[model samples]
Target: MNLVPGSEGGFAALHAWAIATAAVVAAGCALVGTLLVVRRMSLLGDAISHAVLPGIVLAVLAGGRPGGFAVLGGAVVAAVVTVLLVQALRSEGGVAEDAGTGVVFTTLFAVGVVLASALARRIDLDPSCVLYGVLEFVPFDTVAVAGLEVPRAFLTGVVVLGLVGAGLAATWKDQVFAAFDAEAARAVGVPVAAVTTGLLAATALVTVASFEAVGAILVVAMLVVPAAAAELLVRRLAWMAVVAVVLGVAAACLGYMAAYRLDTSAAGMIAVVLGLEYAVAAIVAPEDGVLARGAARARLAWRVRCEDLLARLWRADEARAGPPAATGPGDWAAAAWLRVSGRIVRDGDRWGLTAPGRAEAETVVRSHRLWEAWLGRHVELPLDHLHPPAEWIEHHLGADVRRRIEAEVGGEESDPHGRAIPRERGRPNA
Candidate 1:
């Protein structure tokens, strides 16, 4: 094993091969996986990969070489068989869809296991390699195509990916409808069963092509996780597929490099790298991630709450002809934080807003008072109920939306509670 981590030339060649191989396979898997996920048939993709092993073993036993035409033929057959058997179990045997898939694929996988073990000596089949092919050794299997030595696996995967891509493009509308709602598609005579069978076959072909480069087990991660992550980060299905392909290719390249650096398996490294990508998306996704949007919402809510407290304190001060002599329990805590943040000041138990605090406090009061006036006009809610509802909505209303609401309420100058509605900030003092 030349463990010196291939030279730059060797590394570039290896990287190119890995990227080409992963891109083609990942695109197909993620594309189909998107449909599977949308239709809630993700478990079916899992079952198809395992179940196709027997068909491939049989093809090989019947004089078919691994990575040759026979394996692909058998794979499609196995995929179709798995689908049919699952359907049979669901309709005839009265089993649940998932349970039927479990029974069908597990049995097929066991058969493949027995055959691979029994025929190990007769064929170029290694049981471990059957489950997870030797990706590092893939570059060693060079085939001369038009006098250029290229990794056979890379070439084969590219061709398969092209075929899948072309086929999908040709039938995208039908497939999209089927995926969105199979029963509706069926009702409209969209041949849902045939479309489903075609999808399964495409998935099986992609799986087999990738099997040599990344193995069967990890392909599941590439197929599903990228699509799943992309779904989290994108709304449209087309964009989701695009994002998944990008993520898949990136993870493959990064994983391969990391594996080479650390002297580990490339497939395992890719899976780990993909997992990290998903963790990042979960934490940093805009509008949805746990950290980014949550923090943003929290900051906005806290700011609104603090401003509300300030405006209330300001009202108390106005009623007494000076700064408030005593702030409430909630406002006192808010005032302390505001004072520490230089947004407010306290002198001998009296509280007053700083220059910045006055602007912010006025905005809150404007939003609250405007909302109360609007509710009094448009809603049947009582005056007392207005403050609590406005208190919550004040965080979401922007300056423009507030202005629109202000117009809708006929430029109301006072809330239902008769307190003056503060003027918009950045305007000269009235």
Candidate 2:
């Protein structure tokens, strides 16, 4: 392909070809990976990737070139055999799925390595290339397509990607159903077995397509990492697939550039980049990410502290008592924040609620007492137990919910504790 251009071009052309090839391979892996992740069959994908090495070696020994149709066919057969073995072990031998996967893949991979070593003199395949890959050398192996020389690896990746994408599109609904609930999907006539077999075949195709770029070992990261990251970022399957492909492509480009600059392995760099993407997704995911959930907890805690302080002040005012003690650091901080926010004000040496704060405090007390009354009527809790539940529930009840509780408790004037339930903010008391 002459990717390196001297008077014609430069190494820029080679770098571009390499990066593009990596991106294509990554995209295909991500597509298949999305389904594997969703179906919890990621280990199966890993198994297929390793187990297919023997097939590739055998195909090469049989005069099939790497990244060619013959190699791909052998790889798919190997993948199917791997899956059948796993199923047989689970059903007949009562071996666990994970154990079966481990046993089958490792054993097959060992056999492949032995074959590759023994036949190294006869085959064009390199043991190092099987483990790591020869992406740098991919540009040198070109075939003419439509009168234009293109890298063989890239062409195979594109063809496999298109086929996998088309097949999935035609049966996305069935795949989704089977992934989530295979038994139910089968009951509904969704052809669960066929769908699963198709996925295994697709996994094999993508694995082999990636074999020249990332190799058999690192291809597991290409297949699983981006899809796992996408699952964290998105809720829907279609969006997850789209996000996974985008992430995988971006990682491929960045990783290739990084490897070029650092003078390291492109496959290793690509796996590193995918790990970084997953880490970023885990930290920043919307609902369940560490940062998001932490922030939510902080916000709720702050609100609860503020409302608790307000309700305490209202209770003191009702009892004609002095200001509540701000004994703890949290209490003092909440008090200072409430005063600065205009919810509390300085009155002589004590703190008092502002007009708006009084209204808010009244609502809180109303919620608390109404809940206590409702629990008293509905539950057989002791009067002492009523206060603790109401105390916690006070912060969560909205005006509408409080009003409903109020009505359901017969518009109680007093709680089970014999304390008067404050009226709604705008209601007049006779």
Candidate 3:
């Protein structure tokens, strides 16, 4: 398993193993993190990632190999203790859960640091590796398996990933039920407490498995960032978990390669790459993302401007006057668009609605006056106050709702402001 000097194959194998280990461990963290995020326990994941360090150090001190069952057991126990402490502080001492978690995990992490530093010789725990991890050296520690030298960290990661994935899969329904509404789930006979405990244990197991490859500091990024990003990208719990795992694995691979090229810490680079993924996800997510929301707003604004121009021209024609002056850039753009789209035409110095344009303009004006009449009839709003609400709502009314409103207002022919309500044109709203 040792690397020979100037060995290209050896170095390539080493890098592959390291990236594989990171990807596997990242997947495990992402799976567990999905439930954590769904249940709003992401901070608890962060707490457990740091607090498990003390248990790991103690386990190593008690003669457990780094990725052994003994070490995993110790981590689970520490994770349980951390949760219990946080709850106790919340219930008995009236402390906030987040504040209590912060206090407990930091204190335990500090103790682990002191113990690791003090017992460096016996425990052989390096402080630098404890924080940032030594991903570059992961391949160096190999265990012989089936006549091949395999990295122990990679093996541990695979095992942890399988375990966490199976455990979550078996409890997916209950996990979701408990996540969205614990009280309701408890009322319906779900084992909310056991589910929560199992999640905490899984968090510890994955955190410890990732210790040698990505370490405590970067592990939280693997756990929370991918899940958070996936949440933005998908709505279903199953798809969210799948997307989170994919994102985590991608980050691990890309981040490791980037770190190798940059001669930097792979763990730090992986975290950075995860942050970048979240940023991209926030921008491009299907709904509620920055781009999607902005596009929706822009479309609405454009529609409003165009519709306002049409309604204004229609009213001018009704008033037996020339077109209104294009006061703003929006009006100018809208008028030009109307002309280009054959919705309006230039008649000398005035703009006139085309045949189709007059019908569409009548519809807009009809929707506005219908809403205003409905509000005046139902809401008892004053004459002057009706225009603004009706104006804003005119763009949103569909044909079906407009008909219903028209019916509710007893087919009123005029709004409260004495403006005649335009006929419906006997067609669906465009």
Candidate 4:
């Protein structure tokens, strides 16, 4: 079996193998990336992805097959060297971590570019191979597996994914502890340093495995984007890892199909798709997404506006005066909603609370005046300042809290302003 453009069956197999390879490698990257992002070592992953190129080229030159265990070992060694060089610069030379990282990775990556270009014929690597991978050509390179011809890139991706997944699972608790509190974890004998070394090694392995399929830069995108999006969608580390792997694989499959349809770079399309997934996650995430937060704010504002309207009407009723005119946008909206709910009625250019509304209004006024009394008793603020705090807090007080505050305020009938404090409905005054 030959994989050539002229054969329809070969082209179909090529597409399937390419997508499968991308998905498996993306999963590996996502798993390692979850830890890296949580530990705030995402920059380290990016550096390793680019910096391993010279080591890989050297290993291949030394007769180690590309995507083999020897190549993986070389990559891990290169990644460790990159981290050590960065740390040395930071500790010994008094350089900042970010600055040291910038210097080390860029220098090493540049050296790799030169080596790969200089020995292009020997290593079969070109300039494009350094940045954009040869994913579309993956099926052309095959190895026999159990009487079946399998694409070597896909096999490499599966092996790396399994190794990374198993390593992370076996050390998940330590990883979580170190991610959140490295100093405390180390003090408690969690082997944070070994865990960190293993993580870096895993990053290097995943990066090298995906190198032939998605290149250096796009692999970084695969490593960071899905994990970041998953973090936004979940709070637990285990759940986050699962979601990240799913998102990464979905992005890989969708991106490959899109690239095939559009006749574009598959690696580039995969990165773009990952970006889109992150944007969507940011907008619609479960608890703290932009839309969810906005809706929560709106609901709180609505409750405050309506409660203020009711309290104002109650005060007017007490004074035996007409309701205050609704002038502001907030007042008008609250007024319309109250009238619709039968909490208020239009009486010839004025408003008045119904019987049920009056009871609820009394509760609001009680909470407000009780808070004002408490503030006046404990806080040294002037009368005017007390009103501001009570006005802001009145809507949040519940019956139990109000009862507690009423007792704490020593059953004061009048606030510091000398206004009559409304009693809680159905409760006898002391």
Candidate 5:
């Protein structure tokens, strides 16, 4: 097929079918991947993918065709075996977790490879086909259901994805508790082992279904990257799952289009795009992402330092103290910015706060002192220890928490160091 850019006028149906197929596969991978990432068992997903080959080959040899129940059964058995062997090695041989997983899955994969090679003449199985299924040709395979022809692979992916989705929804709470604190979940009789086993089996099924469209190795990318990206974007599990599903589906559609445009493999394109999504999330996500919170904190710290410097400048002018001592680098930069903003003026080499700057400066000092007073009453830290923590926290504390602290402390007049606390809004009554 000659690749073309943009959606052609007649390709709407094709695009819809492709995107629907991709979404089904993406959802399955993301759902399973969420649990894998939460449990820190990502390698287990890899193991199951590799080990399913022999079972699939054996099932085919036993007269089961692709997308048949026999193939799913064989894959499930293979997945369970891989998990059991890894557990046994870890418990008995004292092997490290990764090493045990590596040893078990590689051994099973090797066994499958040998069996498939020996039986190649008698079987229709291809090693390359086992590694990567022909997803592009999936729409060609049709079955009559209710007198209507439907893509068999699409139907299979939907059924399997639905089952996984239902199981996850039903066990959502238990899964969350187990993932957050396995020991606590076990103590509460949450059937942690059963949950883990069920998750692994579902992962195996998802991998099998997706293998036709996404291939074996690339399925790992679908399973981990979206969920991992969502984790960066959200804190709550439900939100994380929701975000992950959306991201996965979007990536699936966009990747397929990109691959078609570039005359590339759809599976490879989706994996590459998913990796890109994760990288973007890592850079731009708030709170924990590399760029977001870091930049926010940097800006906030600079603001605080500037305010402090302005306040110090005002006090220096009032007390007839020479120039304020050189402040920290961030504070110095903030001071320069503040001066440029017309909130401060440079008188010779020394800086002085403008009237507007003095007001802003007072608000910062008031927040700091109120926090110190609150801490002195509520926390048992020493006088000097109180300042450092309050310095960071004073920025985040809202007016409501300040009022609550004031009420708790009976409206203290002075902080631990006997410094008169600044009033809110420069009002004496405050």
Candidate 6:
């Protein structure tokens, strides 16, 4: 179907084709990238993307079309060769993996650059296209399919995505097991080597597919950035892949629009958008994100302060003394919160626990004293050392655990400090 009403003359059609092509390529990259990031082979993905340039230029010189299957075959061969050379360097020459990768990919990329530059007039491939890509011109290169014109790059992306996605789906279990623990997977008879090689082949395929839309350099960003962000946002590998694909596609669409409005490189802008997405994930991700973790810590601190305030009030009531002085900002805030919550009320110049507050306060005191008794019985700590540990542990104990500790401590009525351990509000002394 025609994307725009006037297919031949519509600039909107061209823009649509370009953006769609970018999104499809981004999806493919993201799928493979999830595995790469999880396996800690992201740098290898970068190496393969750059190293595949020579293979592509060689294929183009041999009369293969830019986005054709022949070029993809050549790129896969190059990627396999890159991985082999890196392994050989590490095993035979005792070179570090990172250094070997750096040496191999840079050397191969320079060769590709030289080949492209030297044969610019002879081959149909452009050096500029290999470096930065020509996504804007992608729509102009059309192939007739099903009695309709489709951009060749888009067709190539769709084919690669289907193949990669199918391959991953078929072997996802093995891939995941190998990714998290290769030794264990191998001991369990999983094909770790085959899984790794298959992943490398998929990475090469996606890299070549993205090469036309995002080029050699920026394709690394599409490959790793979205996957890394997804890692921050989600816990499961499958969910990570899904989130990465969504993030990549969104960046491609939004970046293409932004680039069109600003007259900039679509690939570069797409990478920028991916970076922004990663930043947002780092800040707002549910479990480990900056905001979520900060909020959790704040809540823990607040609960501790509130419980400490209640315990202080209970102790004052036990001593028949005035309420403890509010010591600092945290104490003042806790006092105000207690008052608002009706846990405490102003008793002339100081705060006193209300009936409901008294019940809760007894619970805290019960936990504190019970723990102190348990520690005094079991641990060899001095009486003075017991209070600090009990103070920290009071918020964590539950009713059942408090009872178990009470039983284990031989039903002690008072702690080692001679302070009476408060009973559960309704329970009689054992």
- What's the C-alpha lDDT at position 51 in model 1? 85
Q: State the lDDT at 235 in candidate 1.
A: 84
> What residue runs in model 6 are displaced by over 4 Å at the alpha carbon?
1-9, 377-380, 425-430
Candidate 3: tens digits of C-alpha lDDT, residues 1-430: 2334476786778888998899999999999989889888899999999999999999999998676667899999999999999999999999998889999999999999999999999886789888988888889888898999998888988988899888888998999999999999999999999999889999999999999888777889999999999999999999999999999999999999889778899999999999999999999998969999999999999998999889998998899887788988888888889899999999897889999999888889989999989888889777899999989999989878988998888877788888888877765332
TM-score of each: 0.78, 0.93, 0.95, 0.93, 0.80, 0.92
Q: What tens-digit string does per-residue lDDT give for candidate 1 at 407-429?
A: 89887788888888888877642
- What are the runs in model 5 whose C-alpha is more than 4 Å off? 1-19, 325-430
TM-score, predicted candidate 6 vs. hidden true structure: 0.92
Task: Using lDDT, rank the candidates from best to worst.
Answer: 6, 2, 3, 4, 5, 1
Which residue window of length 10 is worst by lDDT in model 4? 1-10
lDDT of 2 by residue, 334-430 (tens): 9899999899999899998999999999888988999989999999998888888888999999878987887788777998888999988776643
Query: What digit string (tens of lDDT, one per residue) describes model 4 on residues 109-209?
Result: 99989988888788766678678898888888889999989988889899999999999999999999999999999999999999999999999999999
Q: Judging by TM-score against the true structure, name the best candidate.
A: 3
Local error of candidate 4 at 162, Å?
0.5
Residue-level lDDT of model 6, residues 1-430, one tens digit each, is 2434655757777888899999999999999999999999999999999999999999999998888778999999999999999999999999999999999999999999999999999998887789878898899888999998999999999999999999999999999999999999999999999999999999999999999888899999999999999999999999999999999999999998888878999988999999999999999999989999999999999999998999898898889998888889999998899999999999888788899899888888889999999988888998889988889999999989998998999889898899898888778868
Give all candidate RMSDs, comma-separated.
Answer: 5.0, 2.7, 2.7, 2.7, 4.8, 2.7
lDDT of 3: 0.90
Q: Which ten residues in a row have the lowest lDDT in candidate 6?
A: 1-10
Provide the clashing-pair count of each candidate structure.
0, 2, 0, 0, 0, 0
Error of 5 at 262 (Å): 1.9
CA lDDT scores, all candidates in order:
0.79, 0.92, 0.90, 0.89, 0.81, 0.93
Candidate 2 residue pairs in backbone clash: 5-9, 5-10
Candidate 3 colliding pairs = none
